[model samples]
Target: MSLPLDSPALALRAAIHGALAADAPLAALLGGAKVFDVPPKEADFPFVALGEAVVADWSTATERGTEHALTLHAFSRSGGRAEAMAIAAAVQEALHDMPLALAAHRLANLRATTAEVVRDPDGRTFHALVRFRAVTEPL
Candidate 1:
């Protein structure tokens, strides 16, 4: 069995679980505070921002070599570009520690030259692209 690239939230959870199987430390990427009648806020406060990460999709097992791809996005209400990049770098470093087996033919290859922070007037989201390959030898 193999994982799919447009995987659901559950699948994303599984991918995160697998990536973080080593117990690495990371901060939250989203969800904190509400922009209700409380007050007006700037879009650059560190604490005002939230961090999130998920594996958008990856390849599955097939007769042909499996090509895995993952997209990680971080969001912030304040739209802090620097903060988002920092968080993205942390996530990328964590992913590097994935216990994927090179011998077992399980490896992740990065596609994007760099992780970028995407910001809209509404919010900010960091983007990173990674590709993986999974192979099994013949019995």
Candidate 2:
């Protein structure tokens, strides 16, 4: 069977997308960077992609929970590391230790695990990887 909307993975992703889209600091820095569940093919630079979600069973006999390993990517073409770093900072600020209201699941917590800015092999593209850990349980 397919995963439900209440799936911790989906809820966590949506929460992140919503937070980034609604944050003024992020908007000012990226200026309409499209956030996507998958990397866009024909989109312009400075886009945000919701990357992988690795979920594992983190449950007790009394409750069922999921530990989600999440990655969000930011791509930039200009301003080099400085620009990517700024955007990455915003991502971290927006997400780390932030509370999220999940659809059908309860978010126990969300915290950033790592934030790294890497120079793409293309030489002109900058890649920012933002990783997080989220624990969620049924509502």
Candidate 3:
């Protein structure tokens, strides 16, 4: 069956985007609210983009639920990994264990699982990957 428009994944993504976009510390690190699901062709550096997400059935015998594994990417060209790492830290601070308002679902838990910083293929860019795990139950 097709998932509903307000599926847990979609709702969770929207809530996450909203939270990151509104976080003052994250915005400051990014120089502005540069959180995007799809960054523009000419998107600025040092921005955060919502990356891949995997959803799985987390339902129990009694309760319907979903588990989400989501990834967020931070990009920087500041000559080192510092900027990218800082952006990743801000993202973790903004999201880890934080409550989010998800439409048609109630967030059971959310936490930043892991983060890594690496140089991009071009050799001039630093990329930070932040991953989060979340559980949700239908409202």
Who wins the lDDT comparison? 3
Give TM-scores for every candidate, taking all chains together and pairing residue i with residue i: 0.45, 0.93, 0.97
Among these predictions, the greatest TM-score belongs to 3
Worst 10 residues of 2 by lDDT: 31-40
Tens digit of per-residue lDDT, candidate 1, span 36-102? 1112454333221112333333434653233334445444444456665665565566655454434
lDDT for 113 in candidate 3 is 96
Better of 1 and 2 by lDDT: 2
Per-model C-alpha RMSD: 9.2, 1.4, 1.1
Candidate 3 lDDT, 18-80, residue by residue in tens = 999999999998889999999998999889999999999999999999999999999999999
Q: How many steric overlaps are in each model, in order?
A: 11, 0, 0
Q: On residues 14-86, what C-alpha lDDT tens digit does candidate 2 reach at each position?
A: 8888988888888788787467777658877787888988999999988899999999998899957888888
Superior candidate under lDDT, 2 versus 3:
3
Off by over 4 Å in 2: none
lDDT of each: 0.40, 0.86, 0.95
In model 3, which residue pairs have backbone atoms overlapping below 3 Å? none
Model 3: lowest-lDDT 10 consecutive positions: 1-10
Is candidate 1 or 3 superior in TM-score?
A: 3
